[model samples]
Target: MTQNIIRWAQMDDIHDLAYVYSESYRKAYVGIIPDEFLDQVSLNERDQYFRKSLSEDKQKIAIMSLDEKAIGLLIFDFQGEADLPENSAEILAIYLMKDYWGSGFGKLFLNWGMDRINELGYANVFLGF
Candidate 1:
């Protein structure tokens, strides 16, 4: 049987997180966004962003692994955006490897994120692109 897990992401997972972010972003945005722009989505830049953002107090990241291999990422802010309600949480990003698309893992991660946000005392959620 295949085992799937969603767990809190740590600094050590930065590289995989970056990979999922850039790869999925490219796959999802191709044609819709400018090719030149999508071509510039570097893994190193994403890695650096995760390195800095992962340390923030209100930000949370989760990794979705299937049989011990990381294939998806979820990023959210428990403190939410300034324009949102005080008790809201914001979903900053969610990405999955193109290979895993339509396999239902994306919905799983979203449900998990919502549960986590509620557990953290946020009564509402705002999804940001």
Candidate 2:
């Protein structure tokens, strides 16, 4: 059996997060979004973004691993949207490798995020696609 784990993302995880974020976006949105838009998705940019975002106290980023191998990324905000209620949390982003699609890892990963929100005492949640 594989060891599935979900844990907070750290500085050491920036590269893997960027790679997974870029590849997942490309593979999942290729046909739905414009090629030019997709072409602009750069791993370097994502790396820098994660580097900056991870330093912020309000944003939370998590890594999904199977047997110690990084396979997905989760970004959330405990504060939720400015326009939304104060008692809510927001799921800013979620993505898993194409190989893991339809494998149920995504649902498990999402549930972990929800559980975090609930643990934080949030009564409502919002998800950004």
lDDT by residue (tens digit), candidate 2, 33-83: 999999889999999899998877578999999988889999988766678
| Total backbone clashes of candidate 1, pairs 3 or more residues apart or in separate chains | 0
Sequence-dependent TM-score of model 1: 0.95
Candidate 2 stretches greater than 4 Å from native: none
**Collision pairs in model 1:** none
Residue 4 CA error for candidate 1 (Å)? 0.9
TM-scores of the models, in the given order?
0.95, 0.94
Cα lDDT of model 1 overall? 0.90
Q: Per-residue CA lDDT of candidate 1, range 50-128, in tens? A: 8998876457899999998899999888765678988988888999999999989999999998889878888888888
